[model samples]
Target: MKLEHVSKTIRHKVLFDDISFQIHKGLYRLTGKNGSGKSTLIRLLSGLSAFDNEKRLKLEGDVLFLDLNPIGLAPFSIKDNFYLLCKTYQVKLTPELEANVEAFFSDSYNDDYLHASVGTKLKLGLSLLLVKEWDYIFIDETLSTIDNDSLKIVAKQLVKLSKTSTIIYVFHNLSCLLLEQNSRILHIEGGKVREV
Candidate 1:
């Protein structure tokens, strides 16, 4: 994907301006201070928000964006949520996909996703997202609330997924997960983006 001269304005305040970059398949870390437009940038990249100059944006392949809270359909069971998401995405839930979801949650299939533990919910959401094919995946501080064990599982899955998908993750701190080798880190500050 390539973004040229991208800019965003919120409530008459400029968040970023003329930001441009080309991203390839790999792991990327986006870090910056609170209110520094990290989430805004992710939104723009994922097409959740429109850029000032849409013509300057060049995207390739399918894109998936997972926000800080990815636990969808809280009142429903994991099975139900999975079904709903797959339905929304127009994905056919085959037997193999069902088995994968069951394996992801293990014994939590019967429990309400909203009531599940934080780690369990995170694991379930991450596992569910992995079922679909995505060329670019943007996660905005979603894994920060998971436990160490669950974090490890999610990290391993992300590493595996990175082989075929471009992952752009926004983290407030780098100590949360051990990043993969050669992962690029970009810093956003003062409405400017610079590789750090």
Candidate 2:
């Protein structure tokens, strides 16, 4: 996928200007200081937000975006949410898949996901997304709230997913987890992007 001459302006300030880059199949770490347009760029790339030069963007295959606080997971049990997500994606909800999801959350399967802790809810949502098929996955600060153990598990899942899918992760801190060897790190500063 490629973004050419992309620019985003919010209010009266320009967040990013005429940025161009190509994304390949692998893990990518996107980092920048606060208000550097890191999240804005990810939103544009994932199609969650439209840019001024929308026609110049070229994207191939399915793209999935996971936000820090995912909506729609609330107001339902973990099992119900899993089934709902599967149906929404047109993925078959097999017995084995259900069993695996249950094991992922362990005793939290039958509990109300909305009432669960932030970390638990994040893990639950991520576990569901990990099983789905997508060519490109963009994660926006979703792992920042989890515990060290859960973070380790999520990191392992991310490394495994990178083998078959392109992963773009946005993080404010760099020492969160060790990225894969082939992962690329991009720094966005002053509305420009460069590999660091």
The top-ranked prediction according to TM-score is: 2
Candidate 1 has an lDDT of: 0.75
Q: In candidate 2, residue 156 scores what lDDT?
A: 73
RMSD of each: 2.7, 2.2
Instruction: Provide TM-scores for the models.
Output: 0.82, 0.87
Candidate 2 stretches greater than 4 Å from native:
54-58, 174-176, 180-182
Candidate 1 on 1-196: residue-level lDDT in tens? Answer: 7777778888999999878777788888998889999998888878777887554344677677776665667689877877777777777678887886676677887789888876666665576565776788888877776666556656776777788998899866555445645468888988988877
So what's the TM-score on candidate 1?
Answer: 0.82
- Cα RMSD of predicted structure 2: 2.2
Error of 1 at 18 (Å): 1.7
Q: Model 2: per-residue lDDT, tens digit, 82-113?
A: 77877777776677777767777778878897
